[model samples]
Structure formats: structure tokens, C-alpha cells
Target: MKRPNIVWISTHDINPDLGCYSGVWPGAEYAVTPHLDRLADDGARFDAAFASAPVCAPARSAIMTGCFPTAIGTMHMRTKAVPPPEVRLLPEYFRAAGYYTTNNVFTDFQVEIPPTVFDDCSPDAHWRNRPDADQPFFAAFHGMATHESQLYLGEEAFAAATAHVPAGARHDPAAAPVPPYYPDTAVFRDAIARYADLIAEMDHWVGGILAELEEDGLAEDTIVVFWSDHGRGMPRAKRWACEAGLREPLIVRWPGRIAPGTVVTDLVHTMDLAPTMLAAAGLPMPSHMHGVPLFDAEGTLAQAPNQYTYAGRDRMDEAEDTSRTVRDPRFRYIRNYHPDRSAMQHTQYPDHLATWSELRRLHSEEAKELAQGLRPDLLTPLQRSLVAASRPAEELYDLAADPHETRNLAGDPGHAADLARLRQTLQTWQGRYGDLGLRPEAEILEGWRPGGRAHTTAPPAVVRSPEGLAADCPTLGSSIAWTTDPPAEEQREPSPLERTAGIPVADGRRWHLYTGPVRADASAAWFRAFRLGFEPSPEVAVNIAQGVDDAQ
Candidate 1:
């Protein structure tokens, strides 16, 4: 009846091209990662694991709470707010059940940790590390080095350490199944290579942690789970609901408890991890968790049930849009909530980065144009055709036939039934979670402001309008104008700026206004104005407009 010690290692922005997953990765096949591969060989490897959402905060939230991101309104990465404290968060559950809980600072939640949640907040420590030999522990370690922005050393390190790759074996653009959205070039190959290298580096980090657990003689008694917050960070990857963005590498290692070398291909989501951990700890599953425990009748681990895993995408990176996907073993279905918006609006690829001097040297001017065809700013004729012609509603892909999700099956007459079934599932889920599809016009800029400040203004009245003014605030005292530029359309009208002022009416109600500037002592004033439903105080307004506005 003793609870097992738990150690979970999570990496940010990793792809499923590791040595255990596939041999096609040039970097992983050549790089050294003896420890991770050994663990996989001796444990379970999940071939069908997926993240509920492809962004960091939402995905982590789902895993931590065993609830769908949509249910809690944290479907977007860092966009939506975090869950309220009343919810039974996974860590608090373990702590309540007599286990020490600790985290190595992965604070991607929308709100700061409340003082009641954890026993410690220091960088190198937490409650699990407290010198209490009698209690079991639940600990999490997050590795941010694998993040795409920080993978500067990845490419060079891969080239240096993976010299064993055959010279001609390097990825060839012509042979590769290049996604229609991206220009097939050495640049893409180099990007993937760099990504592979970062994954290998993460392998080393996981090995080090596992070795430490073993050194402490807790290896056999500990259940270790390795996963990524989401999929790879690339142009179309992070912000989309495609497999590249929504899928993740999930490996569960529980000695004696989980059968070894068992490959479970059934669909499973990140949320399941929380309930499974709780069940392993002998705690009753909370009714609030939407995920089912993946265990056998005798309380040992078992394969997950066969079902469709879901994922959603909302407002991340430079691109702002909404999308959702559902994938079973055979097929994947995607619903793009904003079909008018280009994928590039949600992401910016390195194709525009002038720092890659090799781009100029590798091709002629015409070739450069071809290479930059999918550039966010300049779409090639073919790119424009694809983007403009594609339907805004739905897409279906037979994943077995096209693992990369290249072709859309929704248009075919033969797939109508399949599409209908998936669409029904999607709609049922939306109703269950109360998804409004797109955010209301009034809420679009409700808490939004330029830079890192929250704006305060009267709650705007929203109305759909062909004039382009989607919202009108009472502060304006009348209907204002708003316009949306459609595809192949001209900017024939000015955008409506609903009237807002820094001052508020003497009434007790409060409003938020976008302050163009800020002054000293804005923090206290910000909360006060927010509470009063008035524009932020002059000090807060100045602080937000000009940033803290003074030396610390």
C-alpha cells in the first residue's frame, strides 16, 4: 500500500523524431544518448501519446488538472486566465494524500502561485525535498533549453558530435515530403537538424536526472514519466492543431508496476497523466477530473482505452487565430475557426530572417523568390492560391496515408460520412465546454493593451457590423465604426476607435482604459482603478504607457 515516489521530466517544444521513435532523424541516429534509449528499452514507449493543446501553458494545465483546456478556458497558450484555486490541482491532491510535492519552476500558468499551494518557492527546492524520510514525493523538473529560440548550440553541436552521419544521408529537399506550406530547401532541413540536436541534448538531461534517482536508490520505487509540453516550434507547428503541433513524445517508466517493452498505440492525452498518477498513489479519483486513469483492474498500469484525442489552438505567437483538431489512429480532423486568417498570422518563420546569408548564396534571385514563397509578408502566387482557395470550415486527413497531413479529405464525396461523424463529435464537445468559437468582440481587447500592461475601459457593447466596428463602448455614447478587410479586398474604410478616456465618472463603477503613458506608483493605482471599474489612475496610466518609468 506504500505510495511510489514520482519524478516527471518535461521538455518544451520537442518533436517525436527521437532515436526510440524513428531512425529518419539524422541527428538523433548519430548523437549519443545511451541513457534515454536504455530507459525506453527497459520501459514502456507510447507511440500514440498526444498533447491536448499545442501551446505550453494550456497543455501543462490540462496535464496538471486532468481537465480539458477548453473546459477551464485556458485553451490558449498564455492568452487565457488560469484555473481558480477551488479546483483540485494535481499537485495539491498528492500533497493532501500525504506526499510531498515540488516543482522545478515551470510557472506558465496565467496567475502567480498562491501562498497556500506550495510549501516553498525557492529556485533549488520545494516541499518534496524537505528532509522527511517517512513521506513519498512527487517532483517535476522542466527543461527549457530545448526551446527553439534557445537552440543556438543545437545545429553546431549536432554537426560536431554527429559526424558519423553519412555525408549524402543529410536530408535532401527533393526527396523529403516537403509540406506544401513550406519551401523545400536546405534551410528547412537545417532547422529540423537543429531541432533534433536539442532533443538529443534533452535526452542527456533526462538521463542525468534518472541517474540521480538511481544513485539515491529510489529508481525501482519511482515512477518516471517523460513528455514535452507540446510539439516542435516551427513556422506552422506551434500555433496549429496539426499533429506536428499537438502530438508529443510520451514515455512512462514504472518498474514492476507497468509492463516493460509494451507499446500502447491507443489514443491518450496529456490529461490522463494526472489521473494515472493519482490512481498509482492510491488516492480516489476526483469527479472533477475529465481524464480516466490508465490502469488495469488490479491497480497496475495498463494501456489506455481506444478513443479520439482532441487538441485546440488559440492565440499564440505573432499569429492570432483559433483552431481545433481530433485524431484517432486512422484519421485526423481539423476545424479552423478563423479561415480568413493566414497561418503566418499566428507564426513567423526564419525565411524572413536576413541573418541566414546562405540563403542568398544558395540560389538565384528567382530561386530566392521561390524559396520565400510562403513568407508571411510575401506569399508566392501558388501560396496565395492555396491560402485563398482553401475552405474556412473543415479538413480531414487519413493519417495512415499521409502522416504529415498534406491532403484534405473533407472535400471528397466518399468521406462525407466520416466528416459528419467527426464534426458531430467536435460540436458535442463544444457544447459540453461552452466554446463561443471566437472570442466576443467586446472581450477581444477587454484586458488587452500594448506592451505588458492591462488596459481598463468600460465593458464595450459588441455588435456584428459590415462597417467593421465590431464593438461600441458607452463611453462613446453612440455606435462606432469597425471594419474587417476580407481576402483580395481593399482597405476602403478607416478602422473605428471606440472612444475611451483616462478619467472615470464619479460613480462607484470602474472601467479600464488604455493608458498611453504611465507615472510612478502605478501598481497600487492599477488595482484600485480596476476594482472601481474606472480608467487606471494617472500614475498607473503613465507607468503602463512608459513602463515602470523609474529606477528600481
Candidate 2:
């Protein structure tokens, strides 16, 4: 069988509250989303699909490379480096396997704008209309219309839905399942309702794209994989290791190839998608990819005694912390690098913030007490004084017992054995991946620096002229003109990381710091990171720099 066209439809922060996942909406149960619903009815739906990281950048990195976020050092957002070149990304693999690859202008690889993931990554008709009609295609798309920045529509939709209630009606705390730690307030309900609206809108877009695929006669030849980068935009959703943050809706459809109406409850991670696609295409899986194909020709997953999935949260919003989690079918284990941080620390609790603001504005008499009681900045519902101090360093959760993960079981005596086993698994993974987890206190005490480089206090300056090999350096006062193309190397010497480093900064002003390597193409983030004196992630940087432009 020849390889089929692949269409990967990815969305931004969204939760599993759709009609398919949650029966809350009208007609959701009998919703006629012929494209997506048909896919689910025809192919397998993974109940346990999860993102490797809860945030966008790292999650995308893991999805693309079939490697954990930490494995590539792309833990944080825009600040962290991109993946080094040479390692084949999922799209690149498809491209090499004789497929025309396209991406719809969304590159969230923790770098600057203009993603560098593909050969034709433009948002124009170019990607929508692949010239290579004879070859099978791979088109990956992401939508930001439902993201936090575009949250107004959801808010408006929610207010309209609740218009029947009197403006001054008191909120019924009993109506909703109050988070053990939070006060059941109207604000919370409002937020959840608004989030649902956003999700509804997102689904509409998903349906639209799938509809277009069908209209263009691409659906039949395509294997449609729909998923989100992470969960929704709420506290404990986007930046945490909890199920709400990591678990994503995954629907895979490959007509006649995958079994119809199958639901895989086995533990699966984001990295697994890449190898699975390669296997489906009859292409040899790269040795570096850590994940396995999800199914065989018989349309069944490989049997195993236990399955493991992992997730990590490095940094998001304002708070920067490190955490890793391991989840089996039965339990979820968390290893927090900085346990002292608040469980909800960098997370933006929109409802809490808005409520705190409203109470102070409307009820001034009680405002002082409420403000005094609550940690104004912490966003926790509790008014405890001591709890605001710092977060703990480690935590464990009995996922079966507490699905919401409201209680921490790390300090419990009864769970010691379970904790130890999970810790061992974590250590084994760390060793296998050569993880550079937070350095030990002793190493820091001994004045250790990553990469063994000292912080230099010198501004960047070009010593060599734009043209290569001048006997003399440019005069200090002379102005250097910018050039479009940097000098091409007939035989470029590989950097330490086997990367090509030089790029034209301005006018033939070739600057080379250290970019890890060249991958699909170099991004602008590569230039900036290299300029910052750290090695640039060639693939990510290039993607960010060039964006989804077809020429890039």
C-alpha cells in the first residue's frame, strides 16, 4: 500500500469539553460534525492521549521530534533554545517519504516569530494549494482564534447565555463541584462557561478545515489526526502537570487501515504520534525517535504489562519552575524540581483575579478583610497567611483516589513504596535521555555553570569585514554597510554541535556565534539566540524566523 496524505489539525489551549468528550452542549450527543465525528466513528479514538508538556512550545517540540521536551532543552517559552538541526522532524520525515508538506502559519517552538518547521509553511493559498498534485501531502495547521488573546467572543457568548438570571442574584455554590481548595463563586462558573464557548468556536473551525479537505478531494487519501497542543487557558490547565493540563482529545482516522470505532485506553504520549505516522507510511522509523507506532496492520496496539506516559512543565506566564510527571493507567507521579513554589504560582487564575477585583470595587467595607485574608498575588482561594510563603519541592498524587489532584500524597507514609518505584522510573528515564535536571546544590556551591562558560560582559562587535578574509580589520569609526547574502561556505567547517553557524545579519555582514545545526531551514530565532551567545536551535529558530511563508 502506498503512503496516504496526512492532515494534522492542531489547536491551541483547549480542553475535552466538546459534545464528543462532554455531553453538556445541546445536540452534542447527536451532533452531526460529519467530518470529525465520522472519523471517530470510523477510526480509533485515543482516550488517554496526552501532551508531553502542558505548554505550547515544549509540547510542539515533543510532538515534532518524538522526544521529550527536556530531552531537547526546550523547556521554557520563547527564551529557551530550539531543537538542533539534523534530527528529522515529523513533517520532514513525511516530506522525505515523498509527500508535499505544508503548515498553516502557526509555529510555537519557543522562539521568535516566523516558524521554521517546513519547506512551504506560508499561511497563503500556496499551502492550501500544493502544486505537487501527484505526490501525497502532509498539511499541519494550528488555530489561535480560540486562544486567550481571542477570549472576548467566549465571554460575550457566556454573558448572553446567562442573561436570564437577574443581575443581583446570588450564586448557588451548591450547583457546581467546587474545587476543594476554591470558593464556589459565580466568577468561577462564568469563567468555565466562557471557556466552553471558546471551545465551541474552536470546534467550528476544526469542522471547517475538515470540510475543506473533503471538498478538495483530499480527505479520502488523507489520514486525519486532530488534537490540541495542550489543555484550556485556566488555572491548572495550561501550565501544570495535572490531567486537566496534559490530557488532550486525539482522533485518528485512516479509512480501511485503522479499525472503526476503536478506543485505545492504553497510556499514550504525544511523542508516539511521529513514529506511528512513519510506520503507517511504511517508512523506517528513525532510531532517535523514542515512541513506537500506535497500531499494527491488524489494527491493535502492542500488548504490554504496563504502559507509561510522561509530561513536563518548565515555565509559563510569569512563574518559572521545572516539573516532570509519569502516569500509568492507574497512577500519576509528579517530581517537582521546585516544590516550594505555589501549586498555582505562575498560573493566571482569571476568575480569582476578576473576583478579587470586583469585591474590592463593589463591597469596600468587606474589601479590606477579603484582601487581608487572601494572598492578593497568589490567586489561591484560601486566606491563609503561612500558605503564601512558598511551594514545596516534591509531590505525589494518587490519581485514582483524587482525580482532580487536590491532595498531595508525597509525605504520606503509606505511599512511600509507590513513590520510590516512580522515583526509580524517573531516574531511569533521566539517565536514558541524559537529562540536565537542576544541578545539585553542591555543584552550584562549587560555582558550576552549564556549558562551563563564564558570563562575559562585552557587547557584540563584528571584527571581520562583510567580505571574508581581510588582511586588516575595519576602522573603528567606519560604517559597515549591510548585505543580503552572507558568504557561502564551499566546505563549511562543522561547529562543535555539527551545526552551520554563519548567517547574513544585515548587508553581507556575516555573523556567526553558534547555531546548533541546520535542519529543514534556519529561523530568525536562530540568529537572535546565536547573537545572545548561546547555541541556537537550528530547526526551531529557523521556523520562528522565517514563519509560515512558502519561500521560507
Pick by lDDT: which candidate is best? 1
Where model 1 places Cα greater than 4 Å from the true spot, the runs are 23-32, 80-86, 126-128, 152-181, 296-299, 302-306, 346-391, 441-552
TM-score of each: 0.70, 0.69
What would the per-residue lDDT of candidate 1 be over residues 124-240, giving only the tens digit for each residue? 643336668767888888877567664344457656543433454444333433455555566656566555555666777788788888777888888888888887766556656
lDDT values, one for every candidate: 0.60, 0.57
Report the C-alpha lDDT of model 2 over 1-552, residue by residue, as the tens digit: 767777888888865544564432121332223445666777777777789888777788778777776766556643334343334457755654557677776665542221122446545513357666767888888776446544434446645543433443323333433444433466555555445445555566777777887787776677888888887665566777777789887888887777788777777786788887887777888887777788654345655413778877876645667788888776678887876676555344443455334333333434465667853442343322112435546667786777666677888999888888888887788778755335432343234225555332122122223332112112221111111233344534434221211111112233322212222233332232221123322221122233423111
Candidate 1 least-lDDT 10 residues: 497-506
